[model samples]
Target: MGERVQTVIVGAGVIGLAIARALAQAGREVIVLERHGLIGSEVSSRNSEVIHAGIYYATDWLKTRLCVAGRKKLYPYLESHGVAHRKIGKLIVACDQEQLAKLSGIMEGARVNGVDDLRLVSAEEVHEMEPHLACTGAILSPSTGIVDAHGLMLALRGDAEAAGAMIAFNAPLEGGRILDDGIALDVGGETPMSLVADEVVIAAGLGAQDAAAAIEGYPAEAVPPIHRIKGNYFALSGKSPFERLIYPVPVHGGLGIHATLDLSGRVKFGPDVDWDAEPAYDVDPARGEVFYEAVRSYWPGLPDGALAPDYAGVRPKLTARGEPARDFVIEGPETHGVAGLVGLFGIESPGLTSSLAVADHVAALLGYGKAQ
Candidate 1:
């Protein structure tokens, strides 16, 4: 028999670490298991580390709710913890006259989602905001921002550890069994071990479906299909052109290849969508042409060969191609009938922003609170 803990969280990503901190602070004996040698090496460290403003999702959606709530908590948490971040804001631009009308709809949706800080700007105001930009109109998301993701994760890890939470690296959950007393996990790492815990949180990003299926009793029908939507990035070679994040109207699968700046003031664009058969991070140089065209629609000043393939992050989407994007699916005992077990699926964009709030939701679902 392996050691028994009050809670075992699989995946030491930002969300997992956040949950670990929350549970440990709640006085629960918690352990975070990660497949990597370090925390946040996968989905947590990838993609645009933007602090979303809760503008793109539906009003009733979990993304909107958690993101709005999480963003509120994150800023203060970041400041108090000395995590590097910036509320630099963002602009969703309309390249043509036809697309200008879409800005109003987007603004309305954002307001409905409780992001009332968003403002629709005319072409003159758009130019005034971003001098080098080309757009008929734009929506300024005043609360949009970026963060030092690594620092945030490190702080979360430090807080959790301070609260008596243990993080076990290289610990990949191979399989598990649901039992009466608790859940059992077969953790594979430097040394394989069998561990049991009273509660389990499956916060695995792309591997969420596989992780859920490993548990023998989880409902198969309830496990939605997972797809890898890979978004590629390209870095700018010259001086940074924009101060704020610049975005085009969202496409069917993603928010379009938008301009995002790191804390260092370096400009990078992308995460243009591509469905991958498997997990791969190679960025083809030829794809730069496509980026050039897409970005040139709003940023015609883009110089030839100015964009270099930077990095790529894969989003674990719940639905297949051509289908509408699905909301974040977090199932607990009440829904999946798995007592003391919770599985988080399709945690993509705004996930970083909504991480803390999501942890609160998970804690509530697992009956971990002051009352408990």
Candidate 2:
């Protein structure tokens, strides 16, 4: 709004908004610029709002660290704010002997990642926990749950606004250039205007790389290539019979098709992995055929036509096809020699759970201490 502020955060997704709140809470003036009319319109609003238990990632990686730490921070925040959520827990089911072999490895991974309370359950115990689920073995994650993502975002916005952070909607960042004075932003629109700031944090999610390209002197190589990975969901029409979230053994690149329950107890299954170069968000009802087969593997009583196209989300993956998946890339001035600027890429799964920790990490990059 004014000529300048202490910081400018690009993108209004959960990550961006959370970062803005953290910075403002640290007593720095902040402004969040969003291209959409409302916040969380992109990856934030689309994904399964599952709070990931620290599993499937290497112990030392940022994904594992942030997810574990953020979960500790988020649960209390949600409860204190009156946001709708359920600690419904989750089960990593083993459909057969081959899958059963992998359960031990998963438990070891979870333990090393500082996740306690992950216990291996036998077929009998699984029946006791979920009578309708068909499985030979399972790993119970009591900390995993779901949140009303939109509601969580609203609370975050309220906190940020209350702390004096300003947000401008429909304000797409056109470009920017680093100067001796400060960083200058060219916000594109009918009333295109330029503003300066001491520091800029780019939390643009899928658009992070593109936004980085717009800034002169920012290295192209430093901006990781953005790959869009599509995940599809199917909503169950009938009342939910299951009480907790159900998942499959950890699969490379994703947690396989599983059942998830919302705060209202509505059941849904989905987010089967599909990679697309151009990336389409539309959910194809025909995919329900595939979902039916997957869901029936664990729940035999699923009725026909009950599973319908629910929604879809695209992951802002940093790796390309045939390449190994990389951890979160939060490039800052030290990496690219662009002072007062930071870029976030590949903030995908577990991102929702890792939102607060990610915000703290970004703030530290800008030389701000953790908010007390």
| Index of the highest-TM-score prediction | 1
Which residue pairs collide, candidate 1?
Answer: none
lDDT of 2 by residue, 1-372 (tens): 338767999999999999999989989899998988999998999887899887888887888898998999999999999998889899999999999999999899889999989999999999998899999999999999999999989988998999999999888898888777678888975566788988898899888888888877678888888888888989999889798999987666788888988888888787888875247877888778889998888898888878888888888988776788788888777788888888888999889999988998888887886421
Q: Model 1 compared with the native: what TM-score?
A: 0.97
Q: Give the alpha-carbon lDDT of every model.
A: 0.89, 0.87
After superposition, the stretches of candidate 2 with alpha carbons farther than 4 Å from their true spots are 370-372
> Global CA lDDT of candidate 1, please?
0.89
Candidate 2 Cα deviation (angstroms), residue 228: 1.0
Tens-digit lDDT track for model 1 on 1-372? 678888999888999999999999989999888888998877888889999989989888887899999999999999999999999999999999888988888988988988899888899988887899999989988889999999999999999999999988888899988888888889897899998889999898988899989988778877889888888899999899899999999998899999999999999998888874356787888889889999999999999989998988888888777899889998888898888999999998889999999999999898875211
Ten-residue region with minimum lDDT total, candidate 2: 363-372
Q: List the residue pairs that clash in candidate 2.
A: none
Alpha carbon deviation, residue 70, candidate 1 (Å): 0.6
